[model samples]
Target: MASIAIAQTQQAQATTSAPSAAAAAAPAMQLEPTSVIVLDSGGGSIKAGWAHDSQPTIMGNCITRPRSARRTFVGNELDQWGDLSGLYYGYPTQKGFIVNWELQNKIWDHVLSSSVLEVNNFAETSLVLTEPLFNFPAIQSAMREVAFEEHGFQSLLHTTAPELSAYQQRVDSPSAQEAQVVVDSGFSSTYVVPFVQGQMLPSCATRIDVGGKVLTNYLKDVLSYRQINLMEETHVVNEMKEKACYVATDLQHELEKAKQRPSSNTISVDYVLPDYTTIMKGFVRAPVARTGPANMSSDEQLVKLNNERFSVPELLFHPSDVGIKQTGIPELIGLVVESLEEAAQYYAYQNVVLTGGNARFSGFQARM
Candidate 1:
């Protein structure tokens, strides 16, 4: 599971770097050339644009939470007050739902009015924004209000991020019988979606409270346990995970190697922090060092790559370890298949398809 996520992350990076490639490959997905805008606003970031395109046209997190409303974007310009403050500083749909009308209004205002976008003529734009699966009706109503009334957006198509991504993947796949599962590992949670014959099985869908943010926090805790004072070093820790972390195929065997003396098989890392050239790159010494705390001595410590961080994320597979009584994924899949009463037409064993950001994880493919 971790491997696939890493691959997806790398692919996302590649897509961002190569816009022309994305644009050229857009038509293969059979998406309508209606200036389609697919928007995904999670708890951590926002991804917005056409579904067929290789990437979002504009990708930027609404960083308003960390800044005051008066903080002007146009140079530290003076003469800022209340009403203008709210207008200038774009709003965000924090806590993973678009509940506040004012914030949604601000978001629409920013997206439409930004100098980078000339989308004032909303009728020409086929807008697609993300919404949670079990989204509250009030929030849905508010979003509709914002689209039609506030933004004058006539063609609004709201879908969940996972669902739309699933749609794209399903459409892209070779045949309709390719049974695939869509796992979305986002900011606040992870969703495992089962698709058979291009349709999603809602009851079989499962969620885990694990994500990049959760893994980051877990790594933070492990480093803290090692007495690493990282009150201001969150970014460094994140970089380390991105560079060095990997899930062990055989946990016990890897743990044994990590138990060996540092000179033998252990990973020795030299985190060269912050000279500010693309964030400090962490290097793992070829001939491992016999240094640092005794607690960091075990092979298990280094073998897992993420230490407890990897295990904590793995808890999604074994929720019982974390006190969640829900069945793990394989069992869940079986249950889901059983529950699909219309299974005569579809073969769960043969046509299983797995696609999604989270579905890219290392062990995910094999496990499914």
Candidate 2:
């Protein structure tokens, strides 16, 4: 949390510093028509900031009850806790949709009122929040009431996450100069929304019921069945997946290599579980030669991994691997575009952009 604050401070250091001769000589900066406070929250995370900023300040969007900590932690406060074993999480959204506004409102209050964001007067800022592609009418109505009557914002522009991603795609992909297909696979689900000149085509947008949570759970089940039981270690399992999992370009070929003779396999690795007394967190350790227990170099327990690494992430491309009938990530995008006008389809196909946390998985774009 301190690091995040420091980073944001550093980002504005130049503008906040004493005015120089160059600064005095330069023309006064002009504000946008709307002094927008862009906030986008999902089931598990929140990305928010002033519209003028280059990037957003992201923080956990859920409240958690960890066995190690006595008091419940909410939002960024979760980062301050230690010994996060056996954490049972409570979220505002279920199955990618917000189901509990009380929790949602509490989190939003923390976000808007906390010193982290420092928005003095909500009435002075134009609020822009991102909603799910298929938002419930009740959720939408409640959100507007909170934004206007409760918080008293000057203005509000509530929309979908894909719309924000698509706008960002335009800014980042200057060469594209056309419509785009935004592939956002976050914690709860995957959404495919097309943007034509920064406007979303809601009629053609589609969503897939798969995401990081499902992927992680699927991986855990496979590992538990074949390697070890991790059913009670959700916290550790999630960390292991983030630190070690990667989307492989060649699924069948990699699986074959994984099953080959030990010397011929490149995918196999040893993940060193952290010794809480010395090291606070677990990590993927460099390959160590397997030997008797007495001959081990470190006390950290090492778990041998092979096919699990490649097979888990493969679920995104082949949901059928987990018996999910939904289409793959790329196929979902193709499904949305094929419904568009003939001319628009070409631009949408060429300018596809992936967003959300799962998009960070290595070789994900390559697989797409």
Candidate 3:
């Protein structure tokens, strides 16, 4: 997911450094480093920073109440927590829309507080916040109200994540200046959003209910059924998915290889789960060349993983595998592009940018 997000920025950088005809037409003017805060609040995390100056401060976007820790982790505070096992999660957003202002306000306070950003006041700076595609009108205005009425920001620009991504790509290159398609695989849901010349084409936007959180939950269920019950260990499960999962370029071929001789198959790996006593983190080790049953270290527990690794990530491409009955990511993206005029379709295809956490999976770019 981090790789894909960085790729999008790099794509923009290449164009920004050497402006093409379309990009040259409207050059970006330099502004004060702290003039505008480009805030991207996704279902899974928040990415916020001063535009054109620094990288965004990233933090988990949800609230957690851990049984062991017995303390509430609001937003980025979870990063400081030690044990995350058997934690109850509280989401401020439902289906990609912010529904709980009270809880979310707590996070915004932390983000904007003097101890964090050192911003004494927001009235002097403009706030640019990214909202989900096809946002509810009430939620949309409510965000603006909070920024102005609650936070006292001088100005507010409420835009969608896909639009910001498209605009960023467009400002650097002429490729994204026309109709461009953006696929944001976020925590709450994946969205197929179209933008024309930096403006969102709401008519061409679509949503897929599957997302990172869903995939993590699904993996937890499958692993519990097939191996161990990791249903309540969300933090550990999420970490496992991030480290072990990858989208398969050829699903059938990979599945077949996993069934073949275990010694030579490339689809197999051994994940060492943390004991939380001697070892604090889990990691995958390179396959050992063995002639018989695998050997385990006395002090460590190793879980042999095969198809489950790719199969979980494959849910993004084939939601039907889990009975969601939706078109795959690429097919859905193609459909959205085909809906545009023939001329725009070419531009849309050429400038399709993938953003959000799910895009970081290995072979994700190749599969799409």
Instruction: Give me the candidate number with maximum lDDT.
Output: 3
Put down candidate 1 lDDT per residue, 108-160, tens digits, no spaces. Answer: 45555544345756765655666766678898787778778766765665556
Off by over 4 Å in 2: 1-35, 174-177, 290-298
Regarding TM-score, does 1 or 2 come out ahead?
A: 2
Error of 1 at 190 (Å): 1.5
Write model 3 residue lDDT over 217-325, tens digit each, in one string.
9988998898888888887889889999888888888899889777787778877877777778889876564434456667877667789899998888889989998
In order, what lDDT does every prediction score?
A: 0.50, 0.71, 0.74
Which residue pairs in candidate 3 have backbone atoms (N, alpha carbon, C) closer than 3 angstroms, thus clashing?
1-360
True-vs-predicted CA distance for residue 189, candidate 3, Å:
1.2
Model 2: per-residue Cα lDDT at residue 80: 80
Expressed as tens digits, the lDDT of each residue in 1-368 for candidate 2 is 00000011111111211111122212212325235566778766887666667556777778988787778887877778767777778889998788888998888888887646777877777676778887888988998999999899876667666655554445456633466777778888887777776567788887777888898788778778877777767768878888888999888788788887665567777787665666678877545543335645566677777877877778888888788998998778778878988877777777887777788778887777
Q: Ten residues in a row with the worst lDDT in model 3?
A: 12-21
Listed in order, each prediction's TM-score against the native is 0.69, 0.85, 0.89
- TM-score: model 3 vs. ground truth: 0.89
Return the candidate ranking by TM-score, descending: 3, 2, 1
Count of backbone collisions within predicted model 1: 16
Q: Which regions of candidate 1 fall more than 4 Å away from where they truly are?
A: 1-34, 57-60, 64-95, 99-118, 174-179, 231-233, 266-270, 275-309, 320-326, 342-346, 349-368
lDDT of 2: 0.71
Answer with 1 or 3, whichever has the higher TM-score.
Answer: 3
